[model samples]
Target: MDIDLKELNLDELKSLQKQVVKAIGDFEQRKRDEALNAAKAIASEHGYNLEDLMGDGPTKKSKSKAAPKYAHRENPALSWTGRGRKPAWVIEHLESGKSLDELLIK
Candidate 1:
């Protein structure tokens, strides 16, 4: 684990620094993933998903699933959950002067 940094030239030092940064980032990711997997195993043993414990992880955000709000007229199967971004079909219909009410599932 001991590095003779004194023998390293400026360019070599810079390259080593970059490598060190990348190694640190990779190590951190591995550690986080390992810890998460361990936590998930413990949670599963207790009959709960990791998400159930963290409520969508360390961020503690929860998203309730919403019913579909928009349906493609030509293709009924094509639908949008209306949670995040609007779908292209919805945008197209809107641009073509169709109202959201027109595509309502009701």
Candidate 2:
């Protein structure tokens, strides 16, 4: 239902404000209950015990001591070689008159 603010008296405006506040509170409570029920249902179907469901703490980082491979690999493209300042390898190849297009894989 559409209401014109210009047509409502002071009492009607106050009553309308109260009704809107109550509706918002009721909708929020319903949303909370629905989410709780869905989570419980998922836990039951997945065979997770109550403690297992409750213990979903913060995610931990990988503890492997070895550094990842390809950490030392140079970028294939020359896009980020710094503005007008090429890396040593690129300068060497360019000084030898090698075509930039041939150096780029793409």
Candidate 3:
């Protein structure tokens, strides 16, 4: 419809702006609902459920790459195996200023 913009004041213009934003939001919500309904209908026609379609399937394991369980565990290659605090031999070598790499097993 044709309207005279000159007759509207700043307050009216602000109100119109708010109304336009609200209308756009409502339209987007309606569109999303329509799309969801269409998807549901398609899923039903195909005998597939939404939950199953979106859920983790039998072959789909977790996407997360878990950290190695024993990554932080003691290095088995070390002489002491690093199970506890440094062993007596390790301490002795350290006190002598000897490198553990030279003394300890590789």
Candidate 4:
């Protein structure tokens, strides 16, 4: 469609800008829905359910901290998850000829 842009004033231009933005958003949603529906139809024809075909599957990984696998015998508050490098106290204890097994939290 051909239109005269120069004839429109500021208010009309602003309104047209909003309409264009809304139209673009609506167009994108329509296209996404169309593609998803087509994919679901094809999956069903192949005897697969939609979730079996395209779902992300599984909940996100938990954020909870792992149980402390090691701790200082002298200070129960000092602990380590046993994942990263050994802490300074742990290193010193090991250097003193005491086995790491002795520092196990359990």
Candidate 5:
């Protein structure tokens, strides 16, 4: 309420600063908990719990790694998913008048 910051020594000021930071963090956490509780109450009134509404639904699909569809001619270990920009080996293969089908892992 009435803190005379000017009267505080260096250590006291540092301690006060730490206390202020902790207080701010605690206040924010309390606010977030309040909001979450309000949201859960609203969700329950709508015949659903918060978790079901936020569950891993189709809209929250996780990305899976694309299987490599193409490989290096000389080094089979080097591969590409045929998704993003072509790798150097793929570029070189194309530059040599070779088709991407030539690198197919099949």
Candidate 6:
């Protein structure tokens, strides 16, 4: 479509620009949706889902919750898996000249 930019006022130009940006974004999204749908259909035909074929998709496997390796001496409810940064309780225990082995969930 031919559009004479020189003929359009400032407001009209701004409106046109907004419309063009929206149209471009919508076009890209539509293309992605179409491609995904097509891929899903193809995967279905092969007795598999799009996620099953693409292991990194929305239905990808997630790491199971790690079991707690240690628990609070006073309150057994407070526990840690010994994975990431130590919790306040664990830090406090260590600060009080206590060993991490003391917190081990026997």
| Candidate achieving the largest lDDT | 6
Local error of candidate 4 at residue 49 (angstroms): 1.4
Deviation from native of the Cα of residue 41 in model 1, angstroms: 0.3
Q: Counting only residues 3 or more apart in sequence or on different chains, how many pairs clash (N, Cα, C under 3 Å) in candidate 3?
A: 0
- Misplaced by over 4 Å in model 4 are 55-106
* lDDT string, candidate 5, 1-106, tens digits: 7999899999999999999999999999999999999999999999987887998444556899999999997898999999999999999999999899999999
List all candidate RMSDs to the true structure.
Answer: 11.5, 9.5, 7.5, 7.8, 9.0, 7.6
Residue pairs in clash, model 6: none
lDDT for residue 93 in candidate 6, whole number 0-100: 96
Q: Candidate 6 residues 16-77, lDDT tens each?
A: 99999999999999999999999999999999888867786666468899999999999999
lDDT of each: 0.89, 0.66, 0.68, 0.90, 0.93, 0.94
By lDDT: ranked, best first: 6, 5, 4, 1, 3, 2
Candidate 3 lDDT trough over 10 residues, lowest sum:
65-74
Cα deviation at 46, candidate 1, in Å, is 1.1
What's the CA error at residue 8 for candidate 4, in Å? 0.4
As for TM-score, the candidate ahead, 2 or 4, is 4
How do the residues 10-102 of candidate 4 rate in per-residue lDDT, one tens digit apiece? 999999999999999999999999999998899889998787555564446778988999999989999999988999999999999999999
* Estimated TM-score for each candidate: 0.49, 0.47, 0.51, 0.53, 0.52, 0.52
* Residue 6 C-alpha lDDT in model 4: 98
Q: What's the lDDT for candidate 3? A: 0.68
| lDDT digits (tens) for residues 34-77 of candidate 3 | 99889888988999876678774455566665332221114544
Better of 1 and 5 by lDDT: 5
Q: Per-residue lDDT of 5-82 in model 2, one digit per residue for the tens?
A: 999999999999999999999999999999988888888898865446687645567965532221112554334323
